[model samples]
Structures are given as structure tokens and as C-alpha cells.
Target: MEDFEILDFLELQQEQQGIDKTARFLQKQIQNGFKISIVIKKQHKFALAPLQQKKNDLFSKQHQPMDVTSQSSEQTENNDKQGSSTSSHSSVKMNKKLIIPPTQNETPEQNNNEQKSEKSDDDQISLYSKKNCSFEHLLKDNLLSQKIQTGLSFMKDGNQKMALEKMMDAYREGNEKLKQCQDQQQISVLIIICIQSLCYASQLLMDFGQFSESQKCLDKCLNQFEINDFDLKCKIYITKAQCNLLNNQYLQCLDNYNKALIQYEQINWRLEVAKLLVKISFVYALLNDFTDAKKICYEGLQILQSKLSHTDPRIYDTYYTLGCIYYLEKDYDFALEYLNQSKEGFIKLYGEQHLSIIRILNLQGVINHLQGNSIDAMELYEQIVCLYGDSQNIGLALVLNNLALVYLDRMKFKSAKLSFDKATAILKVYLNEQHPTFKRVEKNKKLFVAATLSYL
Candidate 1:
């Protein structure tokens, strides 16, 4: 693909909430025979070179002498033959060789000039490293880069075990590399890689429902990496917030999300700021702080609507959160409106069978049930059962419970009992007996039994 096409692809993936997926997509394109480097080089200003190799190349060039007299004669000869020669090509060649350094046999003055040039190059490299963040080092570390690509490929292919294994190995290798580095700059680069590895590992763990493991990874990152760089620090807070959210620590999650939002705002990362606002609004919704959730969700929606495309998928995140908030507030009409929008967006981006679509569908079903549309609600709930049958996912337990409630509402006692029993079985596999979900299912079963006895 062309540079603009690749950029559009990244934008779309990002809108779909796939930040890390963008690079993996590019690698997949490369594997399919695209010359991605040419496109990347054309768009990015910096040349793609290993930093060490670039330094060595500069050092070697500092010792090669140029003959100014011959250069002058050649240029004069080229001017005479300008009409017959490729003037642009000759001038380019001359420009490229203009900075040749003094040889060992040159005068003492020339040797001093070479030393100054060498020092200047070193200074430039140092400055570049500081200003460019970790890109210089990331681009240079081929093995780390390759491991990341492989790990992500495994992730995309649904080999979660292999993916986690590869990513953990990458993390371990980064640690070893860190121990071998003496230069502060090299150490900084390796640490950046380590942080990146931890981020990926934590995200993977979270995806696999290993919330405790994910939290531990984030803690390790916080302990090892000093929070100095704006982007890295913001990401650390965001990851921690997600872990807290998963663990139902709403207040702690809110604190970290707000911290990340502040950093994003200070950096003028408008998209990230908008995204964090939506996330913080979610925490508010969970805490039943509807006023704050509504306010922040609308503000985030405005930012997204103003800055991004009409079709950008991030708009859906805000809409989904708003729907939940409205549902909590019993604003059923508005809840349905926003939830339908979210459902449509997910379907468009990931097709009907996507897990996210399943969630929106479930919420839509709940809304239908609350609105007294029993037939529609039952249809939606049955659709979920068909789509996610016996997956043992937490969402499946939720769907089953809701479906059981609908069955009970219809006085289908036997079906309700069976559905509640299925939910109880699934929840037991994933949660302890003391879990709230287990207690609720047990109560539901007891109530069903009592009602059946009364009917008998």
C-alpha cells in the first residue's frame, strides 16, 4: 500500500481500539509481498539505519579525504558539458561526497578539524537520542523487534499460550540485554523495550482474564521504569487503571485514569485525552455517579466529533459508555438510542459475530425487557445463547442469568430453572462459592424451588 493508504489503515485500526494491532497489520502486509519500508521511508523524515552502524559509518567517513581541486575541476568540466550531461545526477553525486574528512597523512591542522567533526557528530547523535524518545533504539534492536512481531502474530492467530510464551521470552531477553548495557543511552533503550514488553504482556493477560497476573506485570513495570517520559508514564497509568477496573476497584481505577488524562492533556494528545475521559466516565457509571458520567461522556463525545472523522469507531466507545450510564439512570429511550448506535458500530467494524457485538446485543436485550417488549427481548437473548453457547465466558454467565429472568417473567418455570442451573454451573467453574454471582444464583434456585412446590 501507499503511504497515505497505510496511514488510513492505521487510523481505522486505532479508531477500532487496536493501538498495537496497527504495527502487526503492517507486518502482515509485508509478509504478503508489500515493500513496506519504501512506503515508510517516504513518509518518515529520518533515514532507517541502525544507530550503531550509523555512528560507525560517520566515524569511517571522518577519515576519508576529499580532493577539492579534483572536485572543482570535475564541476567545471560538468558545467561545460551541462547540455549533454545529466546535470541533476552529477550535482547529487557532488553534494553527497562534499563532506569527506581528512586522511591520516594530512597536516596537523586537518587532523584537529577531523577531531572536531567527530565530536560534532557524537553531540548530534546524543541530542537526537534525547529528542527522538526511544525510536532510535527501537529501530536498532532487530531481535527484540522480530520477537514482538512473532508474538503479535501468534496473538492474531488465536494461539494465546504461544503468544504469551513468546512475549515473556522477549521480556526476559530485554532484561538480560539491560544487564549487558553500560552506556546510559543503551540502557534507556533497553528499559523502554522492557516497559513495552510488560505492557503487551499485561494486555494479553487481561485479555485472557488473568487480572492478577496483569496487575503484577504493571507493578513490575512501575518498579523498573522511572516515570519521566510523558507517553510512557501515561500508558503506565492507563494500564494500571484497566487492571483496577477489571478487579472492580472503581475508585482506584478512577484515580489512575484521571492521572493519565492529566498527562495526556499536558501533552496535547487530544485523542488519548478524549479516550481517557470516556474511560473515567465509565468508572463514574460503575460508581452510580450518573451526573459526572453524563457530563464527561458528552464532553468526550464532543471532542471526538469535532476532531475525528464521522465514521471513526472511537465514537462508539463514548456512545456505549453513555448507554450504560443512561441505563443506570433509567433513561431507557436514550439508553436504547446510544446502545443501538454502539451495536451498529461494532457490527460495521467487526461483523455480527464479534464478541463486542454480543455485549451490545445483550444490553439491547436488557433494554427491550425493561421496556416490556418480551418477544424482542427473548429473541435477542436466544441469539446470544446461540452465539456463545457453553463458552464459559463471564459474559455467557450474564447472558444466561438474564435469559433465566426473562423465562421466569413468562412463568416458564422449568426453562427458568434449567437456565439458572446452567448459569450456576458456569459461574461455579470460574468463581468461588462465596462470590456474589454464586449467591444470587443460589437464591434464584431456591425461589424457583419454593414457587414450584407452591404450584404443586
Candidate 2:
């Protein structure tokens, strides 16, 4: 429910007094998650022509906020004469959505306001093309989309090399076409194409484990676009964040996630914001910032509770995260409680044998083992071991390790070694000896040997 930037609107009157008043109003309205944007598409249709002319005179495109010395004050006043009548001397009001179309009578002016409302905040900056044809025009004018599409098709088919090549073709095309962009629309189309192709290629490169190359693609895309391109910038930050997440660079992931979170917050896109907050909380939990992690995680669930059903998979995920955090904190009681809730939710949503249940069962088993509830922990571990059904995986390895620990605690050395050996073999294949999971199992082996000797 935090207020965030939803739109950057074009105010027809940017007079010093008017801007001061507008800024003050915006400061107040922003508290409710509103921002200033009043686009009279029909009236401003002609109002934007000089922007193009200004471009022709000097710069390649208008500056962000796209300032142009517009039509005289008198003409602009006459255009909004209808609005000026009852809007109380340009007094601003705020609401969750609608900006209150002046005079609700069905004039084309009202329809224009309807169009503005129909637009998401991102569309507000398309000053020249009021028709919202940018996306359509994007499809039509984008020269390299075929290549980009082919790249994705190759990616879908699991052909990473070919996918990378086609994306390169699109990238080169974008590089060439962007330089040739003479107008705002042309450049806008090229920017989207560039970001789309580059972000896709960046993700593709991530799969290849060429992270530096992947990052270079996004860096180039970021450099190509200016700050005013909020949507495009947001996409790049998200892609960069994904790269960081995959590479386990938690701090960088938090930075990028927070950047996108700010943009989502501005629009008061509560669901997305909540989802990001939960993700951030997970990362914080990974960093052992349990205090903030638990706080943010609960806030996320609260937001979701208002929007989604109680049994929603997303809420279930939040529950699982909280469970994990509490487990890490060694608060087994709360950990089990949340894990049980998620386990039930997942079972109802995806059925008992679904892989989602494996996570809950595994964590719950670990919690039980930590609590010295060997019998309960053994049962949960055995259940998931059966559910794994011959799959060799990290989760299965960890569970087997836990099951062995439980067996060791119960003094069943024979059963313990059998479980421990299986875990050892899996970890040898999947993890380096120095890796934490492997190290844990290896360290346990030493203890197992000592206990065996003592038993002998």
C-alpha cells in the first residue's frame, strides 16, 4: 500500500507559478500513490508538434520530461477552458485511480481522458503518438524481431549456441537501427527492441555460464537508453537481478530488486511489491538478517492476504520462507508451525506427492532432528526418500544426510552408515569436498567412525 511513482505526466502549464503549485500538489497527492499527469491528447496533439520541430532543429530527441516551449498561455488556457470552469483554479485532487474527467458529458475530450485512464503509467510519456500505437508500431517497424524471435525459438528448443547467434544478429541490427533513429517514435521503438533483444540474450548467456558476457549485454542496453525510459530500465534491472540471483550475489540482487521495487511501489502495484518484498526477505534470511527478514516477510504476507486467497500458492511460499528463517534461527516450534501450514496448502493445491511437498517435509524433518525428536524426524525423512523415487538430487542428498544423523543419534550404526554412504556418494558426484554440504557429511563420517570404534 506504499505510494509510488505510477506515471510521469505532461502538464500543459509549466509556468513557474504553475509548476510550483503542481509540485506542491504532487507532493501531497503522492502520499496516496498518485502522481501528476494530465494529458489532453486531443488538445495536446498539436501542442506536441513543436517538440518534433525542436528535435529537427538541434537534438536527436527531446530531453526527459520532454520540454518544449509550447503554445502561448492564452491558447492553452482556451483549450482547457472547459476544465478551468469547475476544476477550481487548477486545484488537484487524488484518488486510487481515475483523475476525474472534467464534465462527464460524452465529448471526444472525455473520450481522450478515458484513453489516458486506459493507459498504464508507462504510456504517459508517448507525447507524440497519442494513439498508443507504439507497441503496434514496434511490431511493424522493428526490423530485427524475426531474429529475436528465432533466437527465442532456438532457446525453447534447447539450442543455446544457435539462440545466442540469432540474438547477436538482433543485437547488431539494433545497434545499426538505433543510430539511424531520427524521430522520437523511431528511437522509442529501437530502444524497446534493443532492451528486449539484449535482455533475452543476457539471460541466454547466463545459461551458458558466460556471466561477464551476459552482463555486458545488459550494460550496453543500459547505456543505450536514457533514464527517462522507465519501463526499459526496469526490465534491465530485473534481468541484472536475475543474473545476480543465479550467481548467488545476494547483495547485488537486493540492490537491483530494490530498484525495481521502487518503480513498482511508485505505481502502488501492491501485489508485485509484496512479491518482491518476499524475495528480498528470502535474500536477507540468506544473509542472516533475520530481524529485518522476518519483518519484511510478514509484511509481504499481509499484503498478499488482502489480495489473494488464504491458501494461495504465493502465500504458501511466504509461509515456507518464514519457516526457513525460523528454522535458521533455531526456533523449531514456529518453524514447524509455518512449515505445516505450507505443507497442507501445497498438498491441497498440488496434491500430496507433488515435489513442492518435498521442501516442507525436508525442512520439517531437519527441525525435528534438531529438536531430538528422532522418531518423528526419521518418519518424515523416510517419507520424502520414498517420494524422491530414485532421483539423485541435492534435496535427496541433504535428506539422506539428515536421516543418517538421526540414525546415529539413536545408536543404529549399521543403518546410519548405509544412509550416510548413499549421501556421501551423491555429494561426491554433485559437490566438491570443500563445499559446505559435502564438508558437513565428511565431518559426520569422522564422528561416525569414532562412534563405531567406541561401539567396538
Candidate 3:
């Protein structure tokens, strides 16, 4: 009985040792697997980190507290469904939809700070968008707008050099901002501003006698803007035509003016069309197509007569052009008639002593001189000389030459020589020696001196 009892004790002890060893092995396996699972979870979160952060940022901007409990419940339900879908898999994977949970026990101050931060972020984004978006936005920005205003003020003050510098700087900055623009409406508005700037710049350049530069500016605008608006296109075409006219590219000028007229007609801009017709008449006169010039001038005058008062500037321009055409045709009677009508318009609008009146007076004097009325022509010339007031400009030079011619006609040898010398000096100072006016004055002075010597 003792030996049997001892054997039973040994078997029980061996069985207890085997059970202990099995339990330890199972515990080690569980520890290693838990560590591997933790590493895998960390790698997964790392891969999803940027997307999760973006979602969190969006939530923060909403100004509402995160519903952590509801999100957790939903995530649990999703995991159950996913687990059922993959029931035959060896292990269950956690759902990867990262829902950031709100922290509990947060102070009111912290929440307020978060809301303020979000608002500040929104404000910054909006500001950035405006600065890069539209011409109106730039025009609204006080600093940027001030640049444009300052440029205009400079131009108004007759400081074109400074105005151009400021305007060009603003334009360049605007162009850079335009490159960043994403919206089409913003692009259209910005383009309009750019075209306006170019137009103004071109006119300014023309005023400074920078004809080539003016043409360059217009070309830049034509290349840059694909304008659809009729008014804007008309403005561009007119500017281009003016530049061509100044360059003496008469055919090109006519073509551009006709294009602008077409656009004007589309909008029923009759007044502008009339003005364009007068300009086209002038071109025809320059080309020595007097018949067409007279026809176009009459067309323009008829249009003006219907819509404008007799004193309208368009009427003045048409009448003046008609007078010139008739004068070129050597029809002094018709020339005087049209010229008197033009002078009446000028006198009505600008009074007798005005420059416009002085110009018409010069033309009338030429007509009188041609008609053998030296006394009347001399009187007109003297009036122009008095209006000059010591200014040695081109207008003054032209009038002095005409005055000299009238003196020569009257056989006032001493007075004619004096006037011719003075006129020649003015021309030589302002104009090229090879200019026709200077050559004509020289030839006339020679003829006058020779005739007087021969008479003596």
C-alpha cells in the first residue's frame, strides 16, 4: 500500500509540471503577438497620419464640438459589419476610419481660443484670395489703389514721366497677380484694367511724341487682350488708328478707323461714327482723293446736323475739313463759305480769341491772299501775330511766314525782309533745315531781295 501511494504522488507531480510548462509557452506566444499587433497598428496610423490631420483641421473650422461618443458607437458598428464580412479570416483588423475624439473637461477659454484661431485662419485665406484674384480687389486695397490714384494725379499735374513710372509699377504688379488668378470673371475684369492702362499709356506716349512707343503699347494690348466687348474694342482700334495716323501710315490708319466704325455701328454709336467719318475724310484729303474727301465730309456733316447742335465740336471738325478740301481744290468761294461756317462754330463754342479761332483765321487769311485781297489778309495775319504773345512755336512761325508773304505782295520791302528774317529764324530753331516751310521761306526771301534790288 505504501509503494502504490508513492507512485500516485510521482504521477501527479509530473502532470502538474507539464501543465505549468504549457501555460508559460502560451503566455509567451500571446506577449509576442500583442507586440507585433501594436507595431502593425503604429505603421498603419503613420501611413494615415496626413489625411487624419486634414480631417481634424476641417472639423476644427466648423466651430462645433466633436461628437466622440457617437463616432465611437458608429465605429463599433462598422467593425462588426466588417468582421462578419470576413468571418473566415484568421484575425480581425481594426477599422481604419480615423475619427478624432474631442477632449472632455475642456475650459471655456480654450474653446474660445480655438474658435478665434479658426476665424483668423478664414480671414487670412480670404485676404490672400482677394489680393490675387481680381482688379476690383486690387482697386479696393488701399495701398494698391493709392498707387493708381497717385499716378492719375501725377498725370493731371502734367508730370507724365512720374505718372508713367508709378502706373507701370502698378501694371507690372497687377500682371504678376494676374498670373496667379484662377477665376475667369476675375480675369476679365483684370484684363479690362490692363487694356485701359495701355490705352492711357499709349495716349501719354503720343503726347510726348513717342509715336513708336505708342505703337508698341497698342501692339502689346492687341496681343494681350482678346476683347469681346464692343466699346473696349472700339477704344483700342481708335487708339491704334491714331497712332498709325501720326506715323503717316494713312492706309493702315484708314483700315483701323473703318474697323472701329464697324464696331460703333453695331452699337448704334452714331455720334462716334460721324467723328470717325470726319477722320476718314481727312485721310482721303491727305491721299489727294478730294472727291471722296468731300463725300465723306458731307456724310459726316449730315449725321452731325441731325443729332448735334450747329455748335457741336463734330460739326466744327467736319466744316473745317470741308473748307480744307475746297481750299485744296482751289475753289476759294466754297472754301470761304465752309471756313466761315467753321469759324462761326468755333466763335460760338470757344470765343474769338481762342486757338481754334486763330487756326481758322490763318486759313481765311490764306484764302484772302489767294484772292488778291492783300489788305484783308494782312489784317488777319496781324491778329494772329498779336495772339502769339512772344511764343516762338510752330503756329507762330506759320503765321509769321504768311505775314511776310502778305508784306511782299504789298511791296513793303523793308517790312517783308524783317518778317521773313524773323520767321526764318523761328523755323530754323524749331524745325529741320530741310523742312519744306524753311526751304519755301528761303526761296521767297531770295526772290523778294532780288525783286527789290532790280526795282531800285
Better of 1 and 3 by lDDT: 1
Clashing pairs for model 3 are none
Candidate 2 structure, TM-score to reference: 0.52
The candidate 1 region of ten consecutive residues with least summed lDDT is 76-85
TM-score to native of every candidate shown: 0.58, 0.52, 0.54
Q: Which segments of model 1 are wrong by more than 4 Å? A: 1-193, 204-213, 227-229, 345-354, 389-392, 413-456
Q: On residues 1-456, what C-alpha lDDT tens digit does candidate 3 reach at each position? A: 000000010111111111111010000012322110100011011224543342243222411222323322222111111111212211101122211111111111223112221222112111122223344564455353467667778776656767777766766765666677766545444444455466667765665446678888787766664433344456567778877765556667777887877655543455565677777776666555566577666666665666556666767867777887776666879988988998898888887877666767877886676566879989998998887677665456657766876776666768878888887786665445654445655766776666566555
In the range 359-433, model 2's lDDT, one tens digit per residue, is 788777655654557689789888988998887654566677667766766667788799889977876654456
Top TM-score prediction, candidate number = 1
Report the poorest 10 consecutive residues by lDDT, candidate 3: 1-10
Where is model 3 more than 4 Å wrong at Cα?
1-197, 204-210, 370-375, 388-397, 400-456
lDDT of each: 0.56, 0.57, 0.54
| TM-score (C-alpha) between model 1 and the true structure | 0.58
Give the Cα error of residue 258 in candidate 1, in Å.
Answer: 1.9
- For candidate 1, the lDDT comes to 0.56
